[model samples]
Target: MTRDKHDFKKVVPFAFLIFTIAEFIPVLAYFFPSSLPRNVLTYSQKRKLIEKRDSIRIQIHTHINNSAKTNKGSDNAPLISQRDFINSTNARLVSKKYASSFDLSKTADFKTAKLMCKFFGLSSIGTFSMLKSRLAAHATFLRTDDSLLFKDLDSTVAGLSTVQLIEACDSRGIPTTNFSFPHLKNSLVGWVQFSNSFSTIEPGFYLWSRIFLLSKIPTTN
Candidate 1:
C-alpha cells in the first residue's frame, strides 16, 4: 500500500507540470506571432507626409505675396486693400483658428485662400461679410501693415475648412445677426455682441482688438 501511494504522488506532480506547460504554450503564441512582423510607418510614408505639408505651405506664401503687391500703393497705404483684406482675413481665421499649425514662412496663397474658406464659415456671403467686418476691426486696431497682416491673415484663413469654422463659432455660443443685402446670401451677417456686464467698452471695438491680439502670437506646430 505504501509503495502504491508513493507512485500516485509522483504521477500527480508530473501531470500538473504537463498541464502548466500546455497552458503556457497558447498564451505565448498569442503575444508573439510567428508568421508576421509588426506593421510600422515606413520612411517613405513619412517622407510623403512631409512633402504634402510643404506643398500647402508654399501655396499660402504665394497668395499673401501676390495680394500684398496688388495693393501696394493706394489711399489705403497702411490700410489693407479691400480685396487683400478679404483674402487675408479669411486666411487668418481659418489657419489660426481651424487648421493644423504649419510653418507660416513656407505657405503659398491658394493654400491660404482654401484654408480661409474652410475655417471662417465663409461658404455664403453673409458669413463672409461677418468675417470681413471682424477682420477690418482687427486691422484697424493693430494699424497693421497690409502686407504683414495679409500673411498672417492668409495663414489663418487657409487653416480651416468652411464647415469646421462654422461649427467652432457655434460651439463658442457667439450670436449671429441678420441683415438684408441684395448681393449677399441669406442677407444675414453674424456679429458677436459685447456684454456691458464684462466691460464698458463697445462690444464691436473690443472684439476687434481681440482679433488683433491673436494675430501677433507666433504660429504653433
Candidate 2:
C-alpha cells in the first residue's frame, strides 16, 4: 500500500505538468499576431473611415480659426505661437509616454493642439479608438519593414513651415507618395495603427515597456 501510494503521487505531478504546458500553448500563440498576414478592409468600410477622417479635419479648421482670433489680441503671440507649434509637433512624433511627461498640452496653444490633432487625428480616446477600429475591421498587423517607408516621408513634412503644413493638410487628399503632406499624415496613422495592433497582442509587454520608460529618472545623492 505504501509503494502504491508513492506511485500515485508521482503520477499526479506529471499529469499537472502536462496540463500546465497544454494551457500555455494558446497563450504563447496569441502573443505573436505580428506574424500574421495583413487583413484588408472592404471598399465601403474604407469609404466610411475616410468620411469620418474628413469630418475631423473640418473640426480642426474651426478650432484653428477660433484660436487665431483669440490669440490676436496678445502682443507676444506670434513668437510664442511658433514655438508652441514646433513643440507640439515634436510631442506628437515622440511616444505618448514621453509626450505626456512633457505636458505638451500645457505647452501648446489651442491652435497648435488643434492643428496637431487635425494632422494626427488625435483625441483623448485616440489610441483606444484605433484599436477598436482595427479589431472591428479585422485589420492585420503592419509589415516590419514599413518603418523605412515613413522615415523619408516624415523628413519631407518636417522641413515645411507651420503655415505650409496647415495649408498642405487643407488641400491634400490621401497621400500616395513620400513627397507630400498626405504621405506624412498616412505614416502617422500607420504608426498608431501598428502600435495598437502590437499592444493588443501582448498588452502586458506594452504596459511593461511604458512603465519601464516612465520609471527612469535622474537620482541625486
Candidate 3:
C-alpha cells in the first residue's frame, strides 16, 4: 500500500505539469500566430521602379515641348513667314499625334497648339494652308464690318502659309507686307490670318496664344 501511494504521488506531479502545459498552449497560440508576409521591398526593385517613373515623365515632357516648338517658333525665332508657320503647324500635328499616343495631356509644358492639332487631325500641309486661307477671310470680314474679330491672331498666323496669306491681304487691299527672316513682325494682316484660323476651331490655349500674338501687333486704329 505504501509503495503504491508513493508511485501515485510521483505520477500526480507529472500529470499536473502536463495539464499546465496543455492550458498554456491555447493562450500562446492566441497571442502569436504564424509569421506574416514582409512589407519591405529590395533596394534594387525600388530603384528600378523609380527609374521607370522618371523616364516616363521625361518622355511625356519632351513630346509636349516638341509639339509646341514644331508648331510655333522658338522664343528667339518667332515665326514671321507664313510658309514657315504652315510648315511648322503641319510638322507639329504629326509630332503631337505621335506624342499623344503616350498621353500628352499628362506632360508639363504642354502647348495648346498640339492639343488643337490632335483634336482636329490637321496633319497635312494642304489642310493647314486651306485652313489659313479661311481664317484670312474671317479677318477681312471683321476688319470691314468692324465686328468682334475672333480674339487672337498670333496663333492663327502660326498656322498659315505665306503665299495664301499674302494673297488674301492683297485682295483685301491690306498693305503688302514683309517679315524679317528670323524676327518676323506681327502685323494686322498676320493677326487677321490668326483670327480667321481660330474662329474655325474650338477655343483653347493654342487658340488663345494665336489671339495673344495677333493682339500684340501695332494697330493703326
Give the per-residue lDDT of model 2 (tens digit) for 1-221: 01112124345544564577756533433442111111222343433444555565546544544554564434644311212222223223333434443333233344443344333332323454343332222212222222333345456556755334432332222222223445545434443333333323232222212222221211111
Q: Rank the candidates by lDDT, best first.
A: 3, 2, 1
- Per-residue lDDT, model 1, residue 35, is 14
Model 3: per-residue lDDT, tens digit, 1-221? 01112124345544564577756533433332111111122343333433333343334334544544555445654232222223335424433444433232333333433333322222213344344433333333434422232343445545545543433332222333233322232454444444344333222323323322321342222
lDDT of 1: 0.30
Better of 1 and 2 by TM-score: 2
For model 1, what is the error of residue 154's alpha carbon versus the real structure, in angstroms, after optimal superposition? Answer: 29
Per-candidate clash tally: 33, 0, 9
For residues 64-156, could you state the per-residue lDDT of candidate 1 as single tens digits? Answer: 445645654466562332222123344344334423323222234443334433222222123434444433333233222222323444354
Candidates, ranked, TM-score: 2, 1, 3
How far in Å is the alpha carbon of 20 misplaced in model 2? 27
Candidate 2 TM-score to native? 0.28
C-alpha root-mean-square deviation, each candidate:
25.3, 18.8, 30.5
Q: What is each predicted model's overall lDDT from 0 to 1?
A: 0.30, 0.34, 0.34
What TM-score would every model get versus the actual structure? 0.22, 0.28, 0.20
Judged by whole-model lDDT over C-alpha atoms, candidate 2 comes out at: 0.34
Instruction: Give candidate 1 misplaced runs (Cα > 4 Å).
Output: 1-40, 73-221
